[model samples]
Target: MEQMNYSFSVCSSELDYDAYLAFLLENYAHIRLPYPFPVTLSFLASPLLMGEAAFLICNEDNQVIGAFSYIRGTGERQYEDRHIVQIQVACIAEEHRCTRLFLYALQYFTQYLAHGEEQVQEFRFFAPSDDSLRRLFSKISSLTASLETDSGPLDEYRASFSEWQSYASQFRQTALFNS
Candidate 1:
């Protein structure tokens, strides 16, 4: 494999906002959102766009190869009031997937949460049913869950953060070796 080079940091105004959105759509074509979501243009230009969340970028040969977004849980924590890190999106160009790009990006994210005082005790991510998200999450120790309803439209499927992570980890490991 070619030498992979990159850096991780909070999304900044200097980056091309449109490219970020395009990157998401291209890498995650399987995701079907409810509507056409806006790109990163707002976040790049607006300070308010930066929330209790973070974005990571992988620059290789002066090109952006991967990006990820993580959010801090807002609700009360069950695990000793510890904050959790939730992954909103994790994308890497297909060409870079075989390398350690995505893995390193994730490592950077976890370290970022290891700051003083407010340490993130957990990490989470969710996946739609079709993907192996559930199985992957289960292996990582995330709690499995689903929508609770007697007879309703939204009562199809769901999984808790912990469950998702547990399963997703399995898939991640598989991907790491298979790649």
Candidate 2:
């Protein structure tokens, strides 16, 4: 029998921006993201180009199979809401979605590895009107959902960072063994 390995690292260079875009485009399609590629690119590109606030989950070969990035905020939040974290452009390749890699990536990324040493008080996750995203977001406890829907095109969810910590705990033993 053979074993698989996955590890995470901070996205450190804008030089790899194209590679990240390709990975995101593929995963976006696999997850059936409702938005068009260009539209999503407009948003994700900013964070990717920043070279921080983004992390990649890669295989032993260093191929990025999953990624998650933090929202850079705007106006006041950009300046003062440092403790509040909003994550966007989170995606895992479909083939890896049902595997242990899913839990590993989810747990690690939620820890805000890119900002692991920083203070984080709250976390926000967003799921568009897509089936795959909705299912992924369901891992959180029902009570954690601050808002379900706004009759808009996209769905927004807000929960404390502690809530994410609770959800991520389930895979601790398995993730430990794998990592």
Candidate 3:
């Protein structure tokens, strides 16, 4: 992402439907996913599962290089919390991974999470329970659960905005940003 002229925008599900769909198709490798690519695509496309906030990270070429989306609230019907969101997806093109692009995009994301319409205070998410990714998030979040799935081991984590800030600050202090 160094010296790259990129743009950041939000995919309003109403107006930018195709944009988000295109990003998902272009980036997802169709491998190691808990559900089939088609199923996942449809689920993301559906209004019921679509996130309230979908951020697109694009390069100078107008191609989506990264995407981070979060649902408005935890999908639990009985548990109502407006300040908490559930991160649905965070994807960065393979070539752009571990680059300054993530660091930059995260700056925008955190700011919005902290002061956007909902003023999200905390978030929770799940990912493949690998040592690499898990270790990174675990440093700033509490591991709430580890579930065995056909695709792989899955882990759930929760973190506050402050905890997320601490995690993001590490990228600024070090040159290495793995996972």
Candidate 4:
């Protein structure tokens, strides 16, 4: 089957947060915390004041199909001051998960990071142990797994900016051949 193509964008005030919240509740309710939907909307609507931002993957009609949020920060005084991009949450519609949407999202995110004011030294995220997410990420960079937690036994993964570039290159090649 031909995969549906999507355009990427940063969440903006003009976009309908109610629709986004409904979609999230319908598809990723398991990941939701006790926080009210308004809180989530507020966070997404805010500027990148706390070194954080959210991106959306949308269809031609501008309907959001996938979303991910990330936070960047320098380590504490005891640890080396390394720039880190930690993916706080990521979700894609079940149908879109089989497509190249996730890869495209990652590519878009890498480009965003590259053009940002601060240099990103590393990317970090906790992915469920049983999921293929870690494997997909490995295509972009080497990952060292950390101990598991109650949240479906997550494994933390880290990668460098150069690794993201390599992944983007591979994604382009694969996408071209497939097309």
Top-lDDT structure, candidate number? 3
Q: Once superposed on the true structure, which residue ranges of model 4 sit more than 4 Å away at CA? A: 1-3, 14-21, 29-51, 74-82, 150-152, 173-179
lDDT score of residue 42 within candidate 4: 48
lDDT of 2 by residue, 1-179 (tens): 35768877767766456566778876665534356667667656767554446767788888888876775444455536767776767777766665477666667766544345667766665565656656766666232443334333576666677777777776653432221
- What TM-score should be assigned to candidate 1? 0.58
What lDDT score goes with residue 102 in model 2? 66
Task: Residues 25-138, candidate 4: write the lDDT tens digits.
Answer: 576564443335665454343324453566677887777777777776534533244477766667787766753676777777877777777888888766556446666767
Ranking by TM-score: 3, 2, 4, 1
Shift of residue 91 alpha carbon in model 3, Å: 0.7
Residue 23, candidate 4: C-alpha displacement in angstroms: 3.3
User: Tens-digit lDDT track for model 1 on 83-164?
Assistant: 6655556666666664355446544554455443475556655444434555544434444444433322111222344443
What TM-score would each prediction reach against the true structure?
0.58, 0.73, 0.78, 0.72
For model 4, what is the C-alpha lDDT against the true structure?
0.64
Clashing pairs in 3: none
Tell how far residue 123 is off in model 3, in angstroms.
Answer: 1.1
- In candidate 1 the C-alpha lDDT for residue 88 amounts to 58
lDDT of 3 by residue, 31-136 (tens): 2346666766654554335436677778899877777677766557533676787767778777777646766666667766655556767878777767878776
Q: Rank by lDDT, highest first.
A: 3, 4, 2, 1
